[model samples]
Target: MNINDIKMVGIDQNTPIEIRERVSFGKEIKKALLKFKETYNAEVVILSTCHRSEIYVYSENIALKTIKDFFIEYFKVTEDELGQYLYILTGVDAVKHIFRVACGLESMVVGEDQILGQVKNAISISQENFASGKILNKLFRDAITLGKKVRTETGIKDLALSISYIAVKFISDEFKDLNDKKAFVIGTGEMGQIAIKNLISKGTKVYVSNRTHSKAVDLKKIIPEIEVVPYDDKYVQIARSDIVISATDAPHYTIDYEKFIKVYKGKKICMVDIALPRDIDPKIGEIEGVSIYTLDDLKKTADENKKKRIGFINVIEKIIESAVNNFVNWFKTLAIEPQIKNINKFADVISEIEFERVINKLSNIDERDKKNIEIALKRVAKKMSDLMIKHIKNDIINKKYEEVAIDFIDENGGNI
Candidate 1:
């Protein structure tokens, strides 16, 4: 987009996860960019992640209208239906928001490291249709740098416990020592595998189960010391497991309460449900001696970490504020520099032509006096030139001469 002016619309966290997932697709970015170009004189980039689906547009109305239209079409929701969940920010605020997101400061888990990678990947994919313009490129570069700063300069980085680790931690807290505690991580999804790795790190006996037997077996092969349980026999594994972390991409619950109660009756079970659809049944949490935690529980734990991480975040915010201000100032100057260069180039030509014109008239004068006259005339010209330069460049920066500025540059080689 134009970099200076930005508009955004989104299916944010306030929207239900089901609705967000329904509209979510890998093709959303490409489709949004293509469709946006039709109705708006602007550039569009779609930022779609599990928690949020937002479109940042350089065009004025397109940013809000185009994205809302897409939401209606993509999610099949009316303006009245989804408007409350969406937010739009313009100009520098939008840029600052993106930087915060890229830095992981706005994540579900505060100070997460994965979001930086996700932001970079999304930026790359969007570039297939849109572009990471100088503005966005510099914004992302600063974001990555800020992420590194947060990691090194703050204890917040260490405090980052992903949903995966949190799930395993919930289970581990129940046991006096996980050294002998048995656990089963169902599914080979990123969350499940991460939970397993974290569990194994805690000295728990780990087993894996997945619909794809190869996936479970592959995980076991990679770990070597782990076990691969049959997907159908998950309840059997659950019965033996002191802790269970279930995170599957399945359309339905993997462990319904009826099946779970049949195998795990009265067993001291610590279950961590990592799936959004919920791999474990709601009733399971009510079972006596059964401790079950879902994404909700993870948020609570994340909230605690966030409180501790807050100390560093205020400092990070200061850095972000200073960095963003400095970036914008430098960025604004970059836009104005070309015009300055243009005016100066023109001045240099006038100075050379006028100097040559006056040189012949001063030939009869003493050498020192002739030089003094030349310098005085050029100095007067330069001062006048400087005043006009500032006025013209300011007009460009303020978009007063935006249309004619490019034409003026093209006509006079100002772009060079």
Candidate 2:
């Protein structure tokens, strides 16, 4: 198999929020992957989150244009807009990118733990849709393994630098004391859960709300002091709270600017939106007496946290490099084993043909002598074939036999 056959294309936090928001995939990610399979006949896995939307494809004959076209159609973006935002990676670069992403090295907040679970969920979804084949299955599994190893082996994740945690830190920096502040949290997803936990730890009273009220109730059970507001009453609770953080998986805006303008009193309020499609409308930020922070806005705090932990980066990078090399070596071995077997089979076939020719010419020889000669010839052939096979295997492992191996297969009619 060719290592360069794997490809990844996507937009991430590095892209402007305007473009990232335009290209972000949400619940329709599965439909998008299925469309890619139907259109390009490619095996794919999609990883879509608030910070990134990436598709990893494993196919023998797929072009960068084909992958880019899928995104242009899916995201409804023009070629110029897509070209400015899209990034393409192939082969070992693709593998290394995945490993780094899983390890949280590529996250907006370095050492954030949420990305690992997001990646695993993406892999599981791909498996359920049969969009993942042999190569992707192995690739994703190895990435997860490296993610776990990096976390355990390095000091990267010692501090809580997640976006949620950073949002709370931003709030704390603004209001020197949160002991008496009331905060409202929307959505009980991973980010919401972390935000609620951090808020409570800061001595802030928290109220939670979700489209599914049951999840809000469940969250309340974890922190009994926290109040659970019904989905419809989110606006009323928002008016009462000092801090409001909205992070839902809704496809559209949960908080309309016009609606918020009516309910929002002329009191100072801090709003933190950590959703991709944006739970709170951007227009809401324009209103007087209200301050809004999106995932992009939290980068300042993320950058500060990253600088403090910059020393551990080299250590984690070394770990990722070692893991990536091991995975590549294993893949190389798998690719070469079939050729090695075919070579040995060809040697056996030639030995048998020559042995038959000699036996036919020795018709006067006795049966016992003929059997003894056959045994000796077989031993000689086995030794010579074994030595040649060993040398070829070593050359392949050292990556020095590609041309010769291809020539051998071509000369033998592509078979033993």
- TM-score winner: 2
lDDT of 2 by residue, 304-337 (tens): 7677677678888888898878778767767656
What does candidate 1's lDDT look like per residue over 1-416, in tens digits? 24446655676656875566666654567666666666564556667765678776654345455556765776676677565676777677887887778667887666666667766666676566654455555666676677777667875755656878667666756786899889988889778867776677568889888999998887765466589898889899899988888889888889988988888768788888889888888898898988888899897877788577767788878877876776665566565566567767776777777877887765566778767866877787689768876666666656687657656755664642
lDDT of 2: 0.83
Weakest ten-residue segment in model 1 by summed lDDT: 58-67
Q: What's every prediction's RMSD, in angstroms? A: 11.5, 13.0
**For model 1, what is the C-alpha lDDT against the true structure?**
0.72
* Candidate 2 total steric clashes: 0
